[model samples]
Target: MAGESTGKKKKTGMKSFIGGTILTDERISRQFPFVVMLAMFGLALIMNRNWSEKTIRQIGDMQKELEALRSEHATISARLMDASRPSEVAKKVNEAGIGLKEPVKPPRKLVVEDN
Candidate 1:
């Protein structure tokens, strides 16, 4: 009998806790949809902020990449300009002990082929 009374008391206590915390009152309980809707809107705003932050960081990284590419392009262009100069080419050729003599060529006849 004592155990039965204790069990009943425990069940009553559990019911009261649920009824007070979740159900609270008739008015609030009936407005459950409004609370849930507001929560969804809050989450949407947080998700939008996170997405925008990531997008902004990506754009910044892309800008840095573009700058790096431009710098590399400029460096390569400068090197090409330097290498294409006749004076530079002649200097390198002379340093490698190149002679400016013309080579003799032998004449040959071309034969036409039918495909």
Candidate 2:
């Protein structure tokens, strides 16, 4: 009789688990908080990984934009340097018919003697 009862208990244990009644068991109910905590930790890990990938993608895009901007800056700086040359300035002034002329004489400084 005792052996038959023990066998029946084991079968009921498996049946309870398969039928979802295991969640209502006293032992499992006691540890429900721990199970929930583990679930939260798993969710947090997934979220962290997703956020890290997003940040990395953004950084890559920013780096590409930075390189483009740097190239543009270099091109503009070269153009500015070319435009600021004395010959270029004189040519532009002549093209504009502004009638401004470069002085041929060297600049002279005047000195005043105070008594």
Candidate 3:
């Protein structure tokens, strides 16, 4: 009788263990979709933050490039203006080995009498 009672207790213990695990599994399965939705929402938030940061960084780089380009344009425009001056043009022409020289005498107007 004692041996039979021990066997019955062992079976009851195994049945309780299995029953507890099954209940736990059912609860977990019921909540699985909620967990997945929360995880996806968190991932979306992280991606949005990263995308905004990257876009802001790109905008900053473009602004810096624009300022640099503007500065270069101003410098080139000034140089061009200086080079277009009459004195500067004469100096450049002389450096090119041209034979042109400033005239010393005033120009005289020629009048043709119509016949």
Q: Which candidate is the best by lDDT?
A: 2
lDDT of 2: 0.90
Candidate lDDT (C-alpha), each: 0.81, 0.90, 0.83
lDDT of 3 by residue, 1-115 (tens): 5546453323335675668754355556698889999999999999999999999999999999999999999999999999999899989889998989756798999999999
Candidate 3, run of 10 with poorest lDDT: 3-12
Please give the clash total of every predicted structure, in order.
0, 0, 0
Q: lDDT: which is higher, 1 or 2?
A: 2
Which candidate ranks first by TM-score, i.e. highest? Answer: 2
Candidate 3 similarity to native, TM-score: 0.63
Model 1 residue 26 lDDT score: 56
- lDDT string, candidate 1, 1-115, tens digits: 5545453322335676677754665555789999999999999999999999999999999999999999999999999999879778777777788775333686678999999
User: What would you estimate as the lDDT of candidate 1?
Assistant: 0.81
> What are the runs in model 1 whose C-alpha is more than 4 Å off?
1-24, 98-115
- Candidate 3: clashing pairs of residues: none
